[model samples]
Target: MAQVGHESHGLTKLEEGFRYTKGISQIPVKSAMREGAQALESARLEALRGRPEALADLMYGGRMGNDEPGDGYKYRGRGYMQLTGKDNYRSAGEALGLDLVHHPDLAAKPENAARIATWYWQHNVSQNAREDVTKATRAVNGGTNGLADRESRNERWLQTLTPELMEQLAAGRIGRAVEPPAPATPARTAPNAAADGVLKAGEKGPAIETLQKSLHALGYTDGKDRALNPDGHFGASTKEAVQAFQRAHGLKDDGVAGPKTLDALKKAEQTPLLSNPAHPDHAMFKQAVGGLEKLGPQAGFKNHAELERAAATLTFEAKVGGLERIDHVALSTNGTGLFAVQGNLNDPGHHRAHVNKQQAGEQPLEQSTFQLQQDTQQRQKLEAQANPNQTQPPPTRAMG
Candidate 1:
């Protein structure tokens, strides 16, 4: 029942129409098409977008017993389990003693849909459904599409259909039983009640205002150009800012300021900003930020803060001798960068330089102010030498 509810979208949508916008077209293209054949060029996909029949033919034609012209649209998915294709319709019709192939639309009717879905489930997924939801999803969906929703629905159904609840419904005592309210008692508040509680959308309070202020201070902003307003209302902008903060901190990006998210936010608030000028490695940080800004989108960094975090990880490794000190950093446009470092600093004889692939915009380990200036000059010189036509900055003199 849970799987049926999920597949049918709470028993609302039972037919496959293939109606989709340009951006949404990619989803079906990836899910429906075979691997490696799923790479439909964007321009070509856009051309087919908003055209359901054409999309159906493109995706379903030449496969799944859809050899005849318009077979794709004729035998399109229908029913709770989305029984699709000419062969499937024929087989299901035979099993249910209905002429589904001749009357495919009949599969969309509630009673017939339920029958077809149950029959399909019994034949294909019932065995796996007893083991794992993921395996059951794979059996039915050909992939784990909407697996999370399926799992959630399964859990809800399990809770709601308990033996006790079933007995109440069977005895017709569901609405008849009403328990009296308990006598009033003194309320006790926990010390960290606000910190523990979740701050989700549609909520308004000083706690939400504090969260908004913290997000704003952490350099997180709404998707729009405007900054987040600490208005005590958890609106779309506040939720967006919270989601951004969560993403930056590697938390679940659900947009709700839950206990974990609130804890992370508190830690982030206490930690100094990556771009803080007073930091010891501020010069190198500034240079990396400048380079990333100059490269624009090609640097593949969302912001300087992300780059700083990645750099910090590498810096710690180098300091502990887990990795050799970085010699040169090369930024690439493909969301990855090359770090030229020695294979092992412990073995001086092994001068073999290793290339470590790091995310773009990551900097080398922290260096002294003088060393950073020299390294910057050397990097510019190397770039100029490689691309002779490109202008370069003059090399810096060694500090006395």
Candidate 2:
């Protein structure tokens, strides 16, 4: 609350303003310009005095992912924490499942401002702040721009939020507590008020049934991995499933199926399933394959065929032999083999490539004799490169 109050000036200034006088502009411009973060000539700075848009563009363009023209002004500081720049907005939007890139002003909306502020603090400052106001201020402002003011606010807030005050507020003895208003009632109940079609708990109908079905199809289950029943009842299990789905897809886990969450769920449902006729558990295998394909060239696979091969190997190992589940797969830098890292997001294993070597004259995955030989040679080369001194035994195969 202190940090937010300091950043947004008591929640009155959600969006940043740039109507600075020539001399006033120089203060922030010069401070932010240190180390060539922003390059503006003295004449140019003086000329940009009262032009908010022009000043914002000059100061913020070409940095912080503001590649497009007018992006600086469009993505200027907003929200309680004054989230600035294209990248920051986009990131917060992804985390919250809000299209902040196109709808940048959403960050300044009273409903979203606090959420964005909290998200920013959690991701960027919480780890380092640790009861230190200066570190928190620097993390939020990129410098100690309001260190003294923030410290003062923190002290004042600490004094105001005593246990007695909290108890009174909780007991309704005091006036309304200082919190953002409850989200406009879900669209199902308040059609006229809701701009976004939102489905919150206690709203049960076809819309919620559809949402539950989508969540079930996408493999989001309750705490015990029990699939959600498409009973059209927005019960606790359904809400938990929705929240789990949101968490996995980098969306805000508010358990309300809003427009953004609905869209992401639809996209996840529509992802193409991989087809490998030879694999047993073809349905599960295809889903795993689809995930790998979605990872795409970014994970270093050169083409679909390579991804298919790696997926086939991992799926086969998981289903037929030694692995629990196909969790992580990565292609080697030189594209020689796949590195399968076992474990889920919570408990990741070591970062080591475990290659399964085929016995001499043995054929796997219907690979031709020549292809098998080539694979053998590549594996040998990789092993040699990995250990030039032969100090340790050759790399062993571990199923992910």
TM-score of each: 0.44, 0.39
Model 1 deviation from the true structure expressed as Cα RMSD, one decimal place: 15.1
Off by over 4 Å in 2: 22-26, 29-50, 128-130, 166-400
Encode model 1's per-residue lDDT on 1-400: one tens digit a residue: 7677767766877887553322333344453444334343332343333346655666677677888998978898889988888989999999999998889999999899989988988888767465587888888877886665577567667756987678778988788865654676765642342554888875666887888888776656664323687877666667767776776556789998888988877766664443566654554445444433554555444455555544443333333333344543445345345332334435565322222333212222222222333444676788888997557567889999
Find the 10 residues in a row with the least total lDDT in model 1.
359-368
Top model number, TM-score: 1
Query: Which whole-number lDDT from 0 to 100 does residue 160 have in model 2?
Result: 71
State the lDDT of candidate 2 residue by residue for 315-393, as single tens digits.
5444433454455665556543454445654465433334432111011222221232344467689988998878566
lDDT comparing candidate 2 with the true structure: 0.63
